[model samples]
Target: METASMSLLHALKEVLSEQQVTENQTVRELHGRDESYHKESLPDLVVFPETAQQVSEIVKLANKYEVPIVPFGLGSSLEGHVIPYEHGITIDFSLMNKILEVRESDFLVRVQPGVTRTQLNKELKKYGLFFSVDPGADATLGGMAATNASGTTSVKYGVMRDQVRDLEVVLADGSIIHTGNLAAKSSSGYHLNGLFVGSEGTLGCFTELTLNVYGIPEHVMAARASFPSLNDAVEAVVSILQAGVPIARVELVDEPSMKQVNLFSETSYKERPTLFLEFHGNEAGLKQDVEFTREIVEDHHCLDIEFETDNAARNRLWEARHNLAYAFIHGHPGKKMMVTDVCLPISELSGAISHAREAVDLLGLPGGIVGHVGDGNYHTLLMIDMSNQDEIEKAEKFNEQIVLYALERGGTCTGEHGVGVGKQKYQQKEHGQALHVMENIKLALDPDNLFNPNKILKTKDRG
Candidate 1:
């Protein structure tokens, strides 16, 4: 270890218990990389703090010693959001996993930052309540909040920012403050909740979160509709939204992705442009909605449609969709995955997706396009042999093409993935002068740039 890192480690050992601080090579290596294809950089030390007070103390020590601190959850972020690029202290929140409280009447739940979305939903299910945001992986609520993650259900319910009612954050200066209260809406000082939720750990660390929840609908229906072409599938989704169908979840999985799902999930779902959909409402209302959705899709060249009301069938259908990424990884041996996503306005989604397919064909890359089409957000899953520099560069160039297309058509570089190292380069192009304002905010809150340095905004030139 470096001399400075050793000094910081000694100071941290004094503040936290010996067991809480470690320079173990295995642990550091594990905390070094996330789910992205980014190169790994191990931290000098990994610390597990159980309380908000301990987090504050760690932040103070990091600030005092001029060391960077990166907060880590399950390391499932796709954009290298949790990688310790600066090689400082990595705060893993695994030991702090706990669901603190549940207010059934108010539809609110207080949880520690380490609590995973699946874990929270399992508990909420007992009370007939559930959390909305389901980001493929069973990501920690804190990590989800950090990225403002959303998925298929975001079409109807909302994203992570909408669900978060309050957060107990530990600032860079070792000060602990609550960003919001339990109320539904407020005309308070500043919208700190919005600012902190998607800051990507560049602003502060989330120790606790109070989030909104929803009751399970009285009746639910799941369906899969196959279309002849990608354009038809996306156009069908646009029409569904325009026609005012209350869709709980609407996901698009292309033919290539469907093949992977079939191979991995041991099911024979037709390998075609398919839309996995769900409706949440009373039985009578859902029937009408499903019938209406079927009619709209058929008009757009839909090949076939299948509906499932049984729990087993619905679970299996969604499971295949959720596990699509893993299926890709399983199919391609000895390759790293690079998943890039962008969001466009619903009106422009058809052209954006059509452009994406053309790019993939032109590049001659083995990739698949899938998305939560209800909200105009989509992802391209690309696998590459990391040893080949040419492949890496080509994949990056392809990603840039897709992002530039989104930005040109009034979209964002990332729909759900936060601006970690991957999307930092496009910030200026997408946000223009507003990028400067974000940098200023980072400077104001973390003047020393001690929190997750070199992420979202680059303070120094890269080689």
Candidate 2:
């Protein structure tokens, strides 16, 4: 007997407008990939639902038909989270791009899933407010929340979870629920909002998000400090943080990364391991921070200090830092960028970075290290030919080794990036019995494992 889900294409054609559903091979193929280094999996169908009500109804149909539903946004995920490997429905949120409310007085903004960070920032500029969780991509706010993403600004502003005030979720059973309240602080029941924010769409579908916003800083300055050695730069960052310099954005890019940026971004920065830093505050406060930061960097045997005080120069400096990922991508066309992230305590950062550099050298991979050093979180972007089996094996071992290094030093397997499929194998080792507790909660919230199944938790095969 044919399952109800087997007839979903026909049912969807009957209920949804033509523009809302499509089984076109091109569309399905487009929806089936993310920015991961993994192989792609095309969904059997792609659906675009425009509202929370529509999402709930579609999920209800999916539940009744026992069809898997994968939520998709900008497809900017570095992990394989957005791929519908089970070949069911992929719900695209492009049509849901609506900014529902801009509560400037409350310093909060409510927006639908499809609104991208750049789009929302452009809109927020008029109000003298901005959202802070930037993952270098103009990714959708829902996607950012799903991954708990962070970028250069995360050192001071925190990640996606820190900004999320509430989430409007569509459960696996087609029930609609709100995960949190509008208040700034809450001692409420279960912290469902926190749970769902980093759930990577495995727990429920996020249709709308209320996020905290910040008033634009009055003054901003960017600086680049190059060290003779990577350890000197690492120690400088530790001292800056320990001394409470109030540095807004402190990023570390190693010598090879700097060289890549020079070639890709067309700017001649020193071809040595460097720290790109930013300070934000009142002019007086910023000046004080700059002086203090310079003293610390110099004390750590700093080689040079270049500060950009003009707004245009400051913007350009950050643009270079933000474009580092793009630089790698542009420099290595046809090769996939296999990026890995691990965060260590400040005390262990220098050692970990040294270990990472050694591994990269031994593996003979064309990769570079850059990170939000203030938080001791870093990423290594490897340019690899996916078809090369030996290269692929080296990448996997390198990732495992780095993760093991971090875990042994009381750090996490992943810092900002959630445990999408790529890091799921390490879940047990990282979380231990806490992993079971997470699985139990998953069972309670999504008993059938219908919502983003095989993501954060494993389950029996529906087949």
Candidate 3:
């Protein structure tokens, strides 16, 4: 019998058009990994499917061969979800990218999985609508759904899961299925939409998505507020959320992260713990919200507050925050960005973050803490020399300690970044009995475990 890789490659070439397949090392290397903590291992092949039919065929072939099929997007995932650990096929969705339909009346847009968030937003702007799941990078919609990603705007607009109204998925056995209808809020069948949204490609591959879009607010404003201490800045976010200011974005930048932003973005942001905020509404409502937020921030001992009412200034403010991860990468010439994501309850956020900061400081690690504070989610992006075993161990320990703290506080090991291979160890600890149910679901959907094998749910050892 032919090897899994050879057989799957042959089947893919036979079914797909000439443009849909490649075994080029350069291209395979590019799709082999994501922006992650894990090391790279190239996939045996790369298949670019342009339509749902094509995707279904590719998955069917892989399933038949009992080979792992890792779905590739923009390669922006912080976890190793896209990495083909079992080394079979990397399905690249870039060719399938297209805006299928835009329903202005219904506030929804149907798009192929490969379309990036920025790409979708650019087209939507003509209709006065925008996709709200901005993960800083222009990540593909399919990757966003796979990771159930949330970002700066998530506190108000909800995560990728919440934005998706429907999904066209290609299951492990190469059967195509629609997860949801256009109608919002359905008590319909088993909530398949929710299951696939964050499934991380373990059960099926998303070929297309009908996502919820938002209208451009009549008024929008951004502000940057500084505090003497990081905890004070964190406290202000808690206060703002509790007061219900309807903040669109509330991001916390530590002094170190602020320094990196200032240096990389060529902006003179004060090197202090700061909260960058955005408010959206009608003119009168936005003004009221800003005023209310100011009062709350001042009460928390805010050192200074600056608001950006103009488009250019507001864009600059958000650009600095969004470009933070890149800033770290740019600042450290040869270092990799190893970030930890742990989310806790609002009440415990400050404690969790404080402990994380102490962990970094105590270990003398070069890292910075920034957070989606309104939602009690934070990340510590550590710039480390990958060659140094000591530094790598420190990064791993920091992640372990922070995750344990969050788990103890009714929080998860990862807030937005899904449990790819990197976070699998924490799954049982976080979910316990729920994990058993997840395993059962995994078995039901892809008993062969060929879809994104060794990710999210690892069953190789059990088998």
Q: TM-scores, in order shown?
A: 0.98, 0.98, 0.97
lDDT for position 278 in model 2: 87
Query: What is the TM-score of candidate 3?
Result: 0.97
User: With candidate 1 superimposed using the best TM-score fit, by how many Å does residue 264's alpha carbon deviate from the native?
Assistant: 0.8
Ten residues in a row with the worst lDDT in model 2? 1-10
Which runs of model 2 end up more than 4 angstroms from their true locations?
1-6
Q: What is the C-alpha lDDT of each candidate?
A: 0.93, 0.89, 0.89
Question: To one decimal, what is the Cα RMSD in angstroms of model 2 from the true structure?
Answer: 1.4
* lDDT agreement of model 2 with the native: 0.89
Q: Over the stretch 1-463, how does candidate 2's per-residue lDDT look in tens digits?
A: 1456558877776667888998889998898888888789998789998899888888888887877888999898887889888878899999999999999999999999999999999999999999988788889998999989998898899988899999999998888899898898999798888888888888889999999999999988999999999899999999999998888899999999999889987898899999999888998898999999999999999999999988887887778888888899898888889889999998999999999999999999899999998998999999998889999999999999999999999999888777778999988998999999998988887787777778867765765
lDDT digits (tens) for residues 1-463 of candidate 3: 2565666667788999767788889998998888986888888888888889988888778767766888889898888888887787888999989999999999999999899988899999999999999878889999999889999999999998899888998887888989899997888678888888888988888998999999999999999999999899999888888887899999999999999999999999789999999999999999899999999989999999999999999999998898999999998889998879899999999988889898989888779999998889999999889999999988898889999999998999999988998789999999999999999999988888878877887786412
Q: lDDT of candidate 3?
A: 0.89
Q: Give the TM-score of candidate 1.
A: 0.98
- Number of clashes recorded per candidate: 0, 0, 0
Pairs with steric clashes in candidate 2: none
